[model samples]
Target chain A: MKIDKQKFPDTDGFFGEYGGKFVPETLMYALEELEDTYSKLKDSEDFKKEFYADLSDFVGRPSPLYYADRLTKHYKSGKIWLKREDLNHTGAHKINNTVGQILLAKYMGKKRIIAETGAGQHGVATATVAARLGLECHIYMGAEDVKRQSLNVYRIKLLGAHVHAVDSGTATLKDALNEALRDWVTNVDDTYYIIGSVTGPHPYPMIVRDFNSVVGFELIDQSKALFGRMPDAIIACVGGGSNAMGAFYPFIDKKETRLIGVEAGGNGVSTGEHAAPLNDGSPGVLHGARSYLMQDEVGQVKDTKSVSAGLDYPGVGPEHSWLKDIGRAEYVAINDQEALDAFHTVTKLEGIMPALETAHAFAYLDHLPKDFDESTNIIVNVSGRGDKDINTVAEIDGIKF
Target chain B: MNRLRKKLDHLISIKEKALVAYLVAGDPDLDSTLDLMHLFVKSGVDIIEVGVPFTDPIAEGPIIQKAHDRALKNNISLPNIIKLVEDFRKVDDSTPIILMGYLNTFSFHKELIDKSDQHGVDAVLVVDIPGELSISSYGISNPNIDSISLISPTTSQERIEKIAKNGSGFIYYVTLRGVTGSSNLDVEEINSNIKKIRSYSDIPTLAGFGIKSNEDARLLSEYSDGIIVGSSIVDMITKQSESRNFDRIGEYLRGLKNAIL
Candidate 1:
């Protein structure tokens, strides 16, 4: 399972047949420029030095891999370790990518930064970096997201970034993405688009994944330093698969280690309301790449539902799709009830409030066998904090938060 | 020769600029789209473009996106769009027709590319697929159907030469560095780029994107061989739903045609 990075995504930015630049001709120049710049700078020692410096001082990288003692006892099977990405400056792993892209934008002399956010995590992250760099910033959010995640909208506004409410199809993350793409295509000259996840056309998926891979590399060293060995399995929630890819890429060549991606099974997969593209969708093109998408036969994107706005996307990252197709990774789904139960249980037992998206990963442990080898170790990526979802969870419980 | 090439050649022989009008199939409804096609011919449109509606059209602006939404609401698909062209062909056999859309619609059925002649489509312009990822190798280059390529303002000169060498029918030169339906046309830049592309190959180059006015069309036609008016025409068709009179669309087409010719 030795991953040959050099052989992937040949000159055209394809990972197998899944990823390509399917964007319009107007934005072709920007994508090509990004590709060339990333290729030149990705391996430079100076760039890495600067990136890691900010990751340490600004976004607080090398987040702890703490052992969840209570969760281990509850599961009664395997020892569980948590990769605490939630402790980052923005309370999510999204800062890892935004910080990298902002640096790239500054290096490219771009004066403006734009992004799309569903749960406001990416928007806050991008706005923070843009403010840090003193650049003009704009964020597109679906109107529905704006209503449900108003605190995030206020945070973005407080950071001096303009939040544009998109009232398009379904009024959600996909619509926000569509609007952000329009803005990028129209203002391609001065603006840098910082995609929030490992999705989109060529260069973006690769770029985001590269920026987030620090999580996996850190986890490898931290685990060996603490426990003297790599974990038996790694789990992360896959909403566009950025955080999961970040935590999984370094260990992909280690066949003995299991990479499990958990997706939202809202209601259930058979109910056709879930956002689990890897589980229920087919291969199609969406948002600029050919990936697994929830679409009708004639190729129109379908609406998706999930308790976590971050996971309510109809498509997944093309790299994840390629990985699933090749059997390099295993994907599973956790329903809303199970995830909510895990959210409450973990918060009470471990004294940590988990985001709904991250809860899906924790909930999967309940489904695993009640016993494992004594030496088995499992790592679960806690991608974000639960502060943003307090109102949502309270409303579901019929409490006035 | 394909009907598009023949029509362009005939227009060039007479020293006239070609006026291409674009309409979304099944917008408002299919019957009105048919009426608009015939009306385009009557208004002196040299060629007709039938845009197959898609859910995610990243390259299009508000006007075309709304048109696509309406078309989808009415259940427009590739087969139905081809049928609309077949119905249009029943009356007018001379005007060249092009099916314009994202690649997913055309790639959905391999036979759709093979049956272009039977469906009376002269050219296929898959907006998302660039020259390097040509579908011609996949049998889209059926002798009767010419596969089109696009050149944007940002396209490098070396890349233009390569795309032009492989392109057939016509090379669509995006007049602005923006999406369809966007404003701010720089006719001087368009003229210069078209001249540069013309130097690379013998294929005809047509200016499109943001050619909204008679002045815009007239100014752009002075540089390129023809002009393809999309958003402006589709915007007019969208207004027809309110006015319920399709004549204004023809009148606007005649105005654009008159300005160019």
Candidate 2:
């Protein structure tokens, strides 16, 4: 499908009927300030030079696009390649966005940085950038997530960022987000909120998507250098839909490339315990954006369950909602067991441990259309490394360590 | 004119300040909320802002957020709150009741908004969707119920013009740069911003958020037409939930009213 990327999120920051600035009046000035600064800086060559230089020198950009030969053979149907965002600094694709936003904060003369995290990768990434920039940083993580992802919490604290353990409303990503927003509202003047996904109100979804689109842009060059054409399909997991939107943005206009977003099916979609909003949820307003959300009949957001902490969100990005409605991309879900099996399979076969979030995309390979042959080249976004999820995997395996 | 405009006009004509008190409906239960509504009027509160409980109230502080949680625990929905308002109207016909909440809870129950006038709901203050976007943006075609728009300290001069011009009932001037219960209200900043809003439109401005003490209400109402007390009142209700002894609440409201007078 020939989707126009620039046309979306109109001046008021909407994508079709979704993605408006549904925040309190207090944050409007800051959002407008950010939008103005970003508009001038996004096209400035000086800004691009600085941004790309940091990506190359600081974040270790051009993260390798490697072909997973063993995984392809295991699948026995099509060629599989991985966008090795795990190779980036901070060991996740989240740094791409943090690196960009930290620079934005600096440009906007903000001295403090605040972020909300679910799996801790984004928190670690934001902390890493804030440390380098010498900005006061605070990260809000759900109390449950703080306990689950303790290593990342320690790392963030070690990097001089304060971690506020939020214990409200399901005490997960959504709650953490609510706390971060409250903090931002409280300290709007000095604090710049670095939202870690393609969620939240306008400009954020657009900004995060633009920063992370380096993944797809790099893949375009790498694919041509290797396979001489775009991949037949691109797969990435959708939590708040940042990574998937990044991978899919550059290919939206390319008719030949198929975009597939995989969501975490904790138990199953029918069981209503999953985080697959696009697959099983309805359109509603949450977190300042109108999107498909796991909400009840009365519009209260539902608590979502997922083995991957990063994928446990009640809502998807509004752009993904638009893409789904327009039939520009396909969204599917993979259960916890299937994602776990895929994690183990890829680690054994390819000698690479993918993040639980990324494993969802890899798990979808088993459910691919039967018509795909050996010539078909599929690229999956390996969003992060699995070191943070080692304890989760161990607990499930009944290992004390 | 609607009941809200009439009440505010009457207050302005008499050179009296409006004391608007906010309480989450069904915090302890719906019957207590009704009793509290009558108490607010009896204690000389000029207007009552009934908080419609929502799951995630991002604009609220811990006190109001906890109140929402307590209300939701009792399965409090928007329709139930509207019904509560209907029940309130059966006894008190003149006092203007405004439903304040997040956008989704009210937007999802558009049918109630359409009939809000019949149920004696004079206004709705949706915290999330402000300015150019109103309840009509969500497909609620009700012309009777006033849409109260908020103007914060951070609002630009240009936006003040837009919001002030578009808003009805009154301009909700967020006194501080924070959530409901945040402190450190810059009186000078609030005064200047309220003046700027008045320069744009003739709507009555009500300063809310962070107005805790009667002194705070007295000082803020000196600049604007009225003052709205939210988190502080909600906090009192939560603390008094066990005792059901709301005389203290009534005392606080009376103090605020007298201070503003």
Among the numbered candidates, top lDDT falls to 2
Q: How many clashes would you count in candidate 2? A: 0
Cα lDDT for residue A51, model 2?
93
User: By DockQ thresholds, what CAPRI class is model 1?
Assistant: medium
Report the number of clashing residue pairs per model. 1, 0
Give the lowest summed-lDDT range of ten residues in model 2 chain B: B130-139
- Model 2 lDDT per residue over A13-124, tens place: 8889889899999999999999999999999998999999999999888998899998898888789999999999999999999999998999999999999999999999
For each candidate, give its TM-score against the true structure.
0.98, 0.99
Task: Encode model 1's per-residue lDDT on B49-116: one tens digit a residue.
Answer: 98999888878898999999999999999888888888988998889999898877777766876787
User: Residue pairs in steric clash, candidate 1?
Assistant: A9-A14
- Name model 2 segments beyond 4 Å from true: none
DockQ of each: 0.70, 0.85
lDDT of 2 at B203: 82
In model 2, how large is the Cα lDDT of residue B193?
88
